[model samples]
Target: MGMEIPDPISIESVGTWSDEVDVVVIGAGMAGVSAALEARASGASVLVLDSGGRLTCTSAMAGGHFYLGGGTEVQQATGWDDSPEAMADYLGLMSPECDPAKISAYAEDGVEHFRWLESLGFEFNRSFYPEKAVVQPGVEGLSFTGNEKCLDVAEVVKPTPRGHKVPVPGDTGGAGLVVGLALDKLDALGVEVRWETGATAMVVDGDQVVGVTWKNYDHTGAIRARSVIVAAGGFVLNRAMLEEHAPDLLAVESNGMALGNTHDDGLGIRMGQSVGGVADYLDKVFVTGPFYPPGEALRGIVVNKLGKRFVNEDSYHSRTSAFVFEQPDREGYLILDSATMVQPSYRFQPLVDGWDTIEEMEQGLGIPAGALAETMAAYDEAAARGEDPEFHKAPEYLVPLDQGPWGAYDLTPGKCFYAGFSCGGLRVTVDGQLLRADGSVVRGVYAAGACASNIAVDGKGYASGIQLGEASYFGRRAGRRATAEVAQR
Candidate 1:
């Protein structure tokens, strides 16, 4: 007999409430924080709520790479010419299917957004070249270089590097940095932050959004807000949502040190849908590489179902996504030999020896031993020849894996409880208005960060710090806009 599946729990039974506020921001992630900060700056009373107990969401769990243009101190030093047009061109080329108008807005506003972030006390370091050869050297190199460079190269645009990282080293630590800064600002601005509050649904009166109904973790009563900003984040955690929304990619398995808050389960999206807010980009899901098993503190590699390597092995984000979306069966392996095991590359060093040996690693990571050995051999040959045979990985640097006591970390598709792909979500106009499917703007709604698309200038998944930059940029804009709307009222 088949196992019985329980019905989806309706949030209404858990809580109920009535309250009013100028702006109710959902999700304490980067986007939510930015939105709240922006709204408060605009002279509005704000209520910021999160489903999780903590303030930071997945955004905080990230590598802290912010993709921006024209303000990074590095761009000025490197003599890399860039502009909003160039940024837009890069985004268009990378994700051609992305809405052009929205992309243009992201690029155009990116300048102002970056500058705004600086004003908000968020410091962005100048561009530094990436250590890995296969990975593009600089953030600017990834988007606005070569034939990929913007068409108006001779315009003397004076492009600033956009990749700004929060000085923190790891995911949780990084989130602490961003969230702490934003929270400090929030407190000063008099924004009301309610922890342990989970938004169950949006409260709609007639055709417009009146507020939101949220509950505490204890399954207690609900709270209400007059105006709400659904920045709760993407549904990467809700396995049912993943299976229902993105079936082709089975599940998302990731490192435990995710940058964003894990509780972000697309409650905002659901609330938006419930209120007839048009949701776009449902099919466009972010995909990341497989890593070592959860709770293990080490970086690892990702191999396909056939136990073969794909993508540049060095890139943590790319490797994670490729392992999740591109591999067969949404399953893969992380190959590590004794040499690599002993002195793993800086990227994988933290993940070394976190799990068992190669064969046991294979069993735990879900791959065959023989196939894993063959894949390692291929990598070995490529390293010897000074090139990546399988993926044509750039030959700038090589790390061999000849030593024994080998290990293979298995990864099967699962919910992205920690980190995964960076794609899809809310649809926003270039001017930052949240849009509906018929190209209509949802009044009083705005979006930024991973929740909104068109700003990923390089389309290389989420850059290290770009989301925070977006949050800062649009958060300011949306805040000012919301404040203005309230003032008019």
Candidate 2:
């Protein structure tokens, strides 16, 4: 069975309203918090609702990478000269269908947004992560969280690292951003925050979304508002929705975990849909099968079932994994020699099989007898010459993998430690206004975060910090526009 969109309750159906506010923001994640704060600052009465009892939304669970560019203070301090045009150009190339207006807006406004986050105590140290990594180690503030440095991307735009992480070590910075920073400010500003309260349906009057109905353990009611913002999240945890929208995820469902918590069930998206909002790119997902962390593993070569190199191993992990997922039967193998092999820094992918020679590895992994040997010989020859004509891997990472005791990591979808979340949701403009198929607006309805198909629409085009960056940035935009409407009235 597929996901069923709920029918919205008409304003006449709710004889009386339990409460009222100028703006009602749903889901207290990064986006929702940003929205509520901005709306309140604009002198609009704001109410925030969370489906869960606590702040464990996907943003809070993230690794705290805010993909800010355009020469943020930290980026300038670290000596990376970046411009809004360069950032927009790189992002535009990331996905052909990504809205250019959103990319331009995000890049142009990123430096100011960085200052805003710093004002909220989201501290960042003035330093750069020096190695290739999925996440920067220790407390450094900037890292390369995307394929900007890859040969293809660097050719189009001057590559610059923009993943601005919180100074907190490890993945706990996300919790710090949500609980330690945004939550306290919300309390100080007296935004009405209701937890354990889930939004059930939108309340419509004619063609406008006037409010939303809600429910908890004991009661059900409606909150009448002039504007409503749904920052709920994506539908990765809902199996039915995944089966209907992005079914490729199910192949690795048992072996991997969803990036989001149980509350990411797509009700917020469905609620928006019921009121004539439309969605696109629903089949996209951000699946990552990381094979490096012994960064030396970049010297290795990844081959498909046909025993040919499919991608540059030095590309971003998600980019590599996205290519792996498209191979025959979603199967791939990483060939590494003894000199390049080490205990992995992360547990995502482990050495599944090893052998003393290339021929043995081919036979062990069920590839045709001579395919692995020929591929290895060609790759080694190119490495020895400090060149990669086929994939254009950087010369620095081009090491000859001729050492003894060759091994392979099972790059098959289920065998690798693949983890991801859905990237598709309701289609919205750069200001976070929901729009229908024919470019008509759903009045009084706005959205941000994972629930809105804003910047992060393509899995293959993903960068680490895009979700949190766009969520908070666009969330503030939604709040401002929603309240501006109230001021007009």
Per-model TM-score, in order, reads 0.69, 0.98
- Candidate 2: count of backbone clashes, pairs at least 3 residues apart or interchain: 0
What is the TM-score of candidate 1?
Answer: 0.69
Q: RMSD in angstroms, all models?
A: 7.8, 1.4
* Clashes per candidate (backbone, < 3 Å): 42, 0
Per-residue lDDT of candidate 2, residues 228-247 (tens digit): 99999989888899888898
Clashing pairs in 2: none
Indicate the TM-score of model 2. Answer: 0.98
**Per-residue C-alpha lDDT of model 1 across residues 1-489, encoded as one tens digit per residue:** 011122222334434455568888877777778878877766678988777766446665555555666434456556566677876765565556767875676677766665655565656545455332222322322222211212232222333345555555433354456676777888887777788887765555555555666677566444444456666676555556656665433343433332234665655666666554555665555444324222121223457766677655444344345445556766554556555542322233133234444556556555676776677677777778776656444344355667666665444444333234435567666535677778787665666556565444332433445456666566556666666766776
lDDT of 1: 0.55
